[model samples]
Target chain A: MPFIKVRDDLCKGCKLCITFCPKQVIRMSDRLNPKGYYVAELFDKEGCTGCGICARMCPDVAISVYREDKKEVPA
Target chain B: MKVVYERPESLLDVPFTYCPGCTHGIIHRMVADTLDDLGIRERTIGVSPVGCSVFAYEFFNCDMVAAAHGRAPAVATGIKRVHPDKIVFTYQGDGDLAAIGTAEIIHAAARGENITVIFANNVIYGMTGGQMAPTTLIGQKTDTTPYGRSVEANGHPIRVCELLSSLDGVAYLERVSTHDPKHVLKAQKAIKKAFQYQVDGKGFTLIELLSTCPSNWGMNPLDSLKWLEESMLPYYKPGVYKDIG
Candidate 1:
């Protein structure tokens, strides 16, 4: 039940993360960001294992992943 | 929800301005993560060098200072000597380090200055429009070397790790590449070790990072990475050149 989020503004559409995702859960979007780069988007959330490889591979640090078992306490 | 992976706290919240597919951002994040993990973010000080990483002062969360071209080692040495307790590092590129700053870095290392250095070798000078650097290999075409690097005109590429391996003042010197994920992981580990050496008051630790300049190399990001694996690794083999206690 891991999840991934892409900060659209931060992503420069290099798509380096898409290639690094072991589960092939990410893909380039048809839409473009303000910076004119085609940002990455999730193709299949169910296929994600929350490996965080995309996060590590991202040059912009735009990807964040949260594992299913970990719950955050209320701030 | 628990965040499994996010930007390191040691880096600013602003976006990096490096060119698309530039590996500088990744290296910055790895250094920031290492500092945060070591609990030395507040005590760390970095010297921003000339070249592509000149704007490093803005990206790193800790205190930072800018230095003249190839003068980062001198500036970092001054900072560390004035504040011995603070962790000091200089971020430099091939043109800045192996070329112009050669004298400064060699003297600093020979003196056994307790500081860490992050050396990025992208083969060509990225910021100045892809000129030939000291680390540019033969047969490589750059802005200056349009036809190709001619051995008769240009000397062979300088291997930084091998050059500094014999220095008694150097506590650690390792070369790592970022062309692939496995190598990137290893580079991060080497970066961590290089910084930790400084934390332990070890002298003159440097990690030469082999990186890509897709825009300058005249290839797409993917192809540039492939070219690096095929062409660069043979000359600048990655491994621990020296890791003396």
Candidate 2:
């Protein structure tokens, strides 16, 4: 389950999160947001360890992370 | 939900290189916990000084920059100015801030730089062996001061907060200690206020933390903390020296 969502509007295109993601899941996209900042895109949600490092280093409150109950079955 | 104390996500999983019972970890925790509560962990830029706490760059999971000896304030100033919206702060130990970096911090506050400073005062230089520092109390004995610090020879310990608080540009100043649980809690409150003051667009903020360096002090952790209370606290009482917030 993808828990970390990057708010395009607030992203400053710093790419710090991309550099710090231990899972190598976040990357800068070619598509620029309205603010002209490159939005970070997540390639794999399942690989996320819920470390929240990306959320902690975003420089902007652009990322939100949540953990899904592992016991829950898919609908 | 059960609550438990743990390292913040903004901190790395790597073990700290600091010595056992060093108060740097406690100061690190205070800053990280503040970031967690303010939900600004992602946006914080931590600047590391050149002394013992220099490796703080590795411990913090957030964006961190290692500044030259006693020059964290200068580096932090640049970062904050370039990224005005980002939460910028510098963590410096006694020698780094109160000694060589003294001019940098004074001018930064004089310029009213919108940044936060976390100053750890352990009285002695921990990394380069226990040398006397500007914050070392008079009559304190160290490797450099084998016969005890003489006021005539070294002068008195600098009162950093008092000096900074008198500056017109300063918006927040607090002196706290990490020696005990009670003081630790109070220090956290002051640390939170320092960060919050920065976020609120207030002027320069500095949190002077009276810390203990057991290894450098040539004493056990418990005795060092006790020395901090009995010897250091009287000279540097914990309180908000100035608060515009």
Candidate 3:
């Protein structure tokens, strides 16, 4: 399964990722960062195909996407 | 796990100072990604302009130089001339490029300087509280043009890519926007191409990005993106205006 990690300290809560994500996997969380900005979180983990559009759209570079390595899987 | 997307190595770990939803961070990442993709991060020297991105020196992991307001092209020219083997690039905003540093950029392109310029045109001066820029469209309301820009008073908005297209020295010129993911991806490709041109010894490649200034534009991030698409796109068409390669 693919997943994204959001760096809470870096996110400005601009919601750009939320706006541009085709899967609508991200949303502005109620929790605020140290800067008082409500950071975005991955709300729909199953919907994320790990396309990385949110990471690309993120101005703060707060999101990092990771996917399972097929080559590392046991046969 | 395999890392699919993350911060480019050419960018430092420090946070950007741009306002929330400001596209400067996006543009910076694209440039950094290009530097990393070209494997020129070690040999790349970036010239920071005096605008909202004035602190760009601190963000890019490569060697950076701070130039006088609108004088980034001039400084980049000097660096490229001295260190021809090193890839030199200038990151500038509208007020810095189209307004005060017009002569520097024009002459640099006219002289066929081999340097990459990432010109971010947000239509308004973001650092200076939404002042009208040379690229500000007519009827656009800015701090300086509270009643909307008038052609008679503000003259006319400068079309930089079109203006520089006729220059014989220009190797590549493209105008792109970062309003949506699709456009942002295209803009990234344009940035990579401009840097590739520089690596190939092509002269004077510039990628003009239509950026958004949400704080200065007095709109939320989403609204500002819409405004950029609806208002700025027709005036500054997004396409390759010139390509010699």
Candidate 4:
């Protein structure tokens, strides 16, 4: 399944990623980073299609999306 | 796993200093991504302007020069002329570009300098606190215009793309927004094209990005995006104002 990684230290909790995620997979976590801002987390891993929209909308460049490559798998 | 989206190598690992929800980070990433995609990061020299993005030199991985207030275009011109092979670009905000540096930008475009300019228009002066800017909308309340900007007092918002388009030296000019993901993608495309034009030795290229200043605008990050779409979009219609190739 495709998934995303959020850099907690870099996330400013602006929620742009949460707002733009078409799948509603991201949410603001109760925990705050060292900077005292809430960081975004992937709540529904299965719902994400790894479209990378969150990464694109992220102003902090804190999100990165990854997906399994089918082409590299054995036929 | 294959990486679908990650930070571009052209950007430094440091977190941006922009306030929470500010769109400068997004525009910075797009420019860095363009540098990475064009494989010109090593040969690229960026001119950092005054305002909120003054520290842009520290964020971008390539060589950077901090220009005097509103002198980014002039600085970029000198750099491009000295190193014709190097891809030179200037990152400037509205206050720096449309206000103090108006003469520099206009003359650079008029001269058809082989350089790229990334103009960020947030309607208000971001760094020095929210004040009336050259691009400030009519009836928009800012620190200077508490009651809202008035045509009789502030005149009208300057449309940089429209003004620069008429110059024969311009090779490409486009105005884009960053209110949504779709528009952000379009902005990236426009940025990449502008850089491509520079690489091809085309005359001056500029891409105007409609950006947001959440802190100065006194709105949450999400609300600022909404404000940009609702208030800014109608006045600054996003589209290609000029393109030579």
Superposed model 4: Cα runs more than 4 Å off? A70-75
Stretches off by above 4 angstroms in model 2 are A1-75, B1-3
Which residue pairs collide, candidate 3? none
What TM-score would every model get versus the actual structure?
A: 0.97, 0.76, 0.97, 0.98
Clashing pairs in 2: A56-B41, A56-B42, A57-B42, A58-B42, A59-B42, A59-B43
For candidate 2, write residues B1-245 as lDDT tens digits: 11123356776766556664577876886788798899998999999998888888888889999999989999999999999999999999989999999999999999999999999999999999999999999999999999999999999899899988888889999999876656777888998998998999998999999988889898865677789999999999888888876
Clashes by residue pair, model 1: none
Best candidate (score: lDDT): 4
What DockQ would you assign to candidate 3? 0.77
Stretches of candidate 3 exceeding 4 Å from the true structure: A69-75
Model 1: residues >4 Å from true position, as ranges? A70-75
Superposed by TM-score, candidate 4 places the C-alpha of residue A39 at a distance from the truth, in angstroms, of 0.4
- Measured with C-alpha atoms, the lDDT of residue A49 in candidate 1 is 78
| Each model's DockQ score | 0.65, 0.02, 0.77, 0.83
* Candidate 3 lDDT tens digits, B1-245: 78877999999999999998999999999999888888999999999999899999999999999999989999999999999999999999999999999999999999999999999999998888989999999999888999999988889999999999999999999999999989999999999999998999989999999999999889999999999999999999999999997
Q: Looking at candidate 3, what is the lDDT of residue B230?
A: 96
The better candidate by lDDT, 3 or 4, is 4
Better of 2 and 3 by lDDT: 3
